[model samples]
Target chain A: MSRLLIVDDDRVGVSALAALLEDDGYQVVALTSSAGGLEALSAGGFDAVITDLEMPGLHGLELVRAIRECSPTLPILIVTGYTNSPAAATAVAYGARRVFPKPVPYEDLLAELGAALPH
Target chain B: MPADDLERVYRWGWLPLIGGCVAVTAAMLAASELLFIHYGFADPTRLQRVLHLVRGAVMSFALALFAGWYMLRLRQRVEAARESLRAQQAAFARRAWKTEQAVGLGALCRLLVHEISDPINGLSLHCRLLERAAGRMEPTDAEPVRRIAAQLRDDTERLQGLAASYVEGNRAPGSSERYQDLSLEEIVRAAVAAHPCPEGVEIVVEAASDLAPVHAEPDRLRQLVEYLLRNAIDPPAGSHRVRVSMTNDGNRVLLAVADDGAGFEDPASVFRPFYPASSLRASLGLAIVRDVAREHGGDTRAANREGGGALLSVRLPMGERTS
Candidate 1:
């Protein structure tokens, strides 16, 4: 089973996406706080990390950079409401393997995650 | 090289020529005075010598003055040529800058079209599917199809708005009077309707029910709204929501669109023409909005929100409606 971490500030948004991803057969860990999420990522071993672009403390791009430094091969996905936004390109530049716009189709996210994760 | 050497020699030759004329004239006058005194035909008084000396001096002075005037005229012509060359260089620089901006703007427009094309094409395909299904199904069965068609239409309009704003960067030139009393709420809603918000993104509008109307060109207002909404929408994909609010403060009405997405690195540079932002869509969108606002005697400003993301506010004066 692929273990995925989901980070977002909105509770409802996180819950809905988590449910959708769960149904797609991925073991998910969702976090709203950036500090706690960073701590968890440092300690816990996650197959893939998917995070929101904008958050209170540590931004999604910062998280991606941190993840890249700690685990260079880890597949990181940046999830944002703004698709095709300049920030999307920035997130990708920061070390995100893939960036998906908000309201990402469950199947699309699943396929992206599947492709990004190492066997 | 021989011709240039000859020209240089000719240029220096004038000084000697003028000096020779002065010397010859002086000798001739001296000779004339000596002959006048020897023959006793004229007085060799101090006044007579002074008068002869003054006449030679005046003639020499006149010749030198004429040559100096001619040299100054030559210098003026050379200076004029240099001035024109400088002007041409400045004009070329301006043209190059404009060309660069146009190319950048064109790329941005192409990207906007590409981004919205998927949703618009999807909407069109869905509509076609609904139409074919409607022809083969009963009225009750077709109800769901109708709903889907409506949603597609809404999404299509949103895409169209995005495409329109993208292309509107190159609108025809016109004077400032070409304005009308426009409803801010309606324009904002139209812009929002035209952009299919990403699946997890929510666009919320907050406007006073009794907000005063503003005098503006309808198309320009729509463009402004499109720009603002585009900026608000382009953030990292997640459960982020964009809020667009409108409020009236007696003299002016304010329209603010803010996003809980990736905020700006430098909020002050947002209004500058061709200032590269986080997104190409954002750079072009803000440029368009700034143009539209200035056209209507208003201004647009962007600032980072305290918590997160960025806020863009456009304030337009509420002119009195003419019946």
Candidate 2:
């Protein structure tokens, strides 16, 4: 099973999304803070990371950069409610594999994640 | 001179001057005729008669000069009036252009907010959660749970409707595009069908039996009606019901939506494009409705309803049927 890290300030949102992914057969580790996500990623083996754009201690782009520096090959996906924010585009430029605006269909996210990392 | 007297003198003094000149010339002619009669005929003192004729000739010249001056004054007055009218038209055009720019900017802001903030995201996520939770329940217990999930889906669609309106508003209205001959009653029905009334809010629709077809962009009209209904039903005002009605005379059609919401906190600023806070979403919605109505040779107005809530009305001229 592919292990994935989910980072978002909204605890309920992160937990809900984690549950959705886990049901689809991936081992999901959910964090409500980006700082914790970085520490967890440093500690070890994760197939991919799904993060939100807006959060405290580190913004989405900064988190993407921090992740990229640590593991250049790790697939990063940004799932944000702010679809129109330039930061989503910036996150993509900084090597995140995909940006999914909130209210995005679960099937679409599933398909994108599958394509990003081999099942 | 008093200001009024000066104005009267300036306007009518030339008329009297011309009239007096004509009278003086006529009097001189009559005096000349008398002089001719007074002069002896046999050895006629023709020189005296000649002198009277000269005086009458001079009076005629003076009368012609005064008449020419009066015509010049009249022409100048007419030119001044024309200039004033042109200035007024220019000012009116400038004001219109400014209003258009303000509206365009407001639309842009509204588009940004609608696109950037997915109000439906949380709701949609909750719907999925409800579905999952329902799946674990007994079949009998799952029925109501599924129904609630369906209602959440309906609310999501309502949010999507708002997003669609933003896109529609961004598109320039074509002289011939997206317009159809639609019944007022049918449009109201469709809008109400899509509306998801909040927990305690009730939505009621009343339409005239014999309603005329309105020639308009279907999306634009839908946006207007849906926005009004959503506004009435969603906001956490004290009211619990919204009443929507349609009525028309032979020449014009009218649609009114009344909400028993907190009645506008500041009724005066309700329809304005931008209000005090980022809560301008409601204001922007109403502004779009008003713009669409005006585009169709109609107008919108708002008022505080008696007892509670607020009333909004949109009036559109009866359009010719293309079908």
Winning model by lDDT: 2
Backbone clashes in model 2, listed as residue pairs: B237-B262
TM-score of model number 1: 0.38
- Considering only chain B, report the TM-score of model 1: 0.45
Residue A29 Cα positional deviation in candidate 1, in Å, after optimal superposition: 5.3
DockQ of each: 0.04, 0.10
How does residue B139 of candidate 2 score in lDDT? 100
State in Å the error of residue A106, model 2.
Answer: 0.7
How would you encode candidate 2's per-residue C-alpha lDDT over B192-298 as one tens digit per residue?
88666667777788887766777666766777786677667766454587888888755568888887777776766666565425455555677667556644445
| TM-scores of chain B alone in all candidate structures, in the order given | 0.45, 0.45
Q: What is the C-alpha lDDT profile of model 1 across B131-198, one tens digit per residue?
A: 55676789899888888877876776666666656545444456234465678898888778878788
TM value for model 2: 0.46
Worst window of 10 by summed lDDT in candidate 2 chain A: A81-90
Candidate 2 lDDT (Cα, whole model)? 0.72
Model 1 spans with C-alpha error above 4 angstroms: A1-3, A8-33, A39-47, A52-75, A78-108, A114-119, B1-58, B61-65, B68-72, B75-79, B82-86, B89-93, B96-323
